[model samples]
Target chain A: MIALLMRDLRLAMRAGGGFGLGLAFFLIVVTLVPFGVGPETGLLARIAPGILWLGALLACLLSLDRILALDWEDGSLDLLATSPLPLEGIVTMKALAHWITTGLPLVIASPLFAVLMSLPGAGYAPLVLSLLLGTPALSVIGTFGAALTVGIKRGGLLLSLLVLPLYVPTLIFGAEMARRGAEGADTTTPMLMLAGISAGVIALLPFASAAVLRVNLR
Target chain B: MELEVSELSVARGGIPVLEGLNFRLAAGHALILRGPNGIGKTTVLRTIAGLQPPLAGRISLDRETMTYAAHADGLKATLTVEENLSFWAAVFGTGGIDAALDGFALRDLRARPAGALSAGQKRRLGLARLLVTGRPVWVLDEPTVSLDVEAVAMFVRAVRAHLAGGGMALMATHIDLGLDEAAVLDVGPFRARAAQEDHFDEVFL
Candidate 1:
């Protein structure tokens, strides 16, 4: 599992764009929203939570294609499938790699994203926390979409079509928690649900990803 | 030890490909699967390697499970040649694939990314993955598709060495692999029949 994770990290790094590209794309989206919404700081702050969540989701979507497509193209996916290691382990490791390259950076850079929207100091912690709990689910669930579409030619648009609907619950709750936190309200309920969603995906999505990959390869 | 498949059947995309197929291979034994393209040669390898579910039958590799290598080379293009070998080596619980790489004359290319390698070089890399796995049974599909003659000889030499070391190989190849009197299993002979009538021409022929 460690070896697979390292290999993924190496690939992302070698690809020369995953980490920075996601972060920059996310930053651009967050930065551009304020311009479009008018330079009203108060308005930006109110919409900040939604903008940030939306940016995160879009950033994740941008890079999801690379998740399985690279391996499928280069033949690594086939090797990993046939390895003695369980498919579940392989899937978990892949999600972890995706998180490190895209999710972790987006989460880490959220404060800058928060500032761009003129978000208050209070909402910053919860914004980060919600992402920490929610993005794993995004990565895991996105992998299933990647697996399902890995065999299709011109699969990128189709992949988003398959995955974005499933992403709604996470995005809604994550953005809501940030909204409540910004208003100095308790966010425990939505935050816990977000955490639960992440845990569930981490545990169960691997089997689904594995099954879909086997189907796609066939 | 022998890898045995009794009454094996496989289906793909909702259609039956092979049915009631039977074969066996012991250490130092090689079985060549001969068939027309798209006739399930690759599917048969996938079944024995445990990548695909067999619709019916059992596959026992040395009375254990087996390993499979496909024509796609199963390599990460981003990783160096050595990293690819080491990854599979670690998975298959083998060591010293440096010798296998060196034997294939891939020593200098060890640090090169797989994407930079030519077609034949990539195929050699794929074969090297199987070698590094060092499993008791090998299920290979089109093991020599992109090789030049020299690389082909290198592959033949590698297979010979593996068989000599008490390993069993099941290879699906169109061209002759030049193995010494391998026990060939012509999968073309075992066609599935909708009714008994489909077998009339086959039986009479």
Candidate 2:
């Protein structure tokens, strides 16, 4: 499992792996919001949490196809399926790799991107916290989508259609937590729900993803 | 290790492609599946490899004892040859890509990225993966799609050595693999017939 994770990470770092594209898209989205919404600080601060959350989600989505498509294309997925390692473990490692390559970077760069939207001081910690707690769910859920569409040609649009619906709960709770924190309101409920969603997804989705992958490979 | 396939049936797109097939391959032997294109040669190999469920019948083998190599080479373009082989080795809980590199004559290209290799070189790398698997049985599909005569000879030598070492192989190919004693299973006779009479049976019932 560690070997698979390490190899995927190494592959992501290499050229054409789209390592920095997610971060670049995040930056571009956040930077464009102020110009489109105008430079009014109050309005920017008001929508900052939502905008940041949306940007992170889209950035994560942009790279979801990378999770398993390459392996499927190159036939590594087939060999991996027949190996001693179970498909569940391979799916888990893929989600972990995707999180490391795409989700983690979005979290790390969020604070910098948040400034462009004139995010309030309190929004920073809550934003980072919500993202840290929530992005794993994104990666996990996106992996399921990737597995489903791995066999199809031009699966990107279809992947978004499949995964974006699943992202709703995470986005609602995450954005709510950040918004409540920025407003000096209690954030316990949304925060706990966000963590619950992440924990549940992390615990359960690999089996589903693995099952889908087996069918696709067949 | 013994691979037993009894009355196996396989389908593509919900329609049966091959049916009522039976074969048993014992240890230290090789089986070559020959047929024209689209006759389900790949299907039989895949069914034996446990990649998909047979529509009907049984395929029994020790799951951990088999490794499959499909048409695609499964090589990561960006990684070096050694990195690619070593990754599979680690995944299979085996080591010694040095032997695999030497077996495929890939020692000179060990440092080069897989994307830089020619078609034949890539196929060699793919074939070399079978060795690093360290498994008793090999299920290979079109193992020699793009190889020169010399490369083909190298593959034949590798299979002979594997068999000599008590390993078994089941390959599907159009070209002759030069395994003098390997049993051949032609899938042409096993092609699934049309379902023209199923409606009558259903109506009578």
DockQ each candidate and list the results: 0.51, 0.79
- Model 1 alpha-carbon drift over 4 Å, by segment: B62-65, B194-205
Best by DockQ: 2
* lDDT of candidate 2 over A1-218, digit per residue (tens): 99999999999999998888889999999999999989999999999999999999999999999899999999899889999999999999999999999899999999999899888898899999999999999999999999999988989999999999999999999999999988888889999999999999999999999999888988
The lDDT leader among the candidates is 2
Q: Go through the candidates in order and give each one's C-alpha lDDT.
A: 0.84, 0.92
Interface RMSD, candidate 2? 0.7
Q: Which interface RMSD values do the candidates have, in the order shown?
A: 2.4, 0.7
Q: Let me know the DockQ for model 2.
A: 0.79
Q: How many Å off is the CA of A60 in candidate 2? A: 0.6
Candidate 1's displacement at residue A4, Å, is: 0.4
User: What 10-residue stretch in candidate 1 chain B is worst by lDDT?
Assistant: B193-202
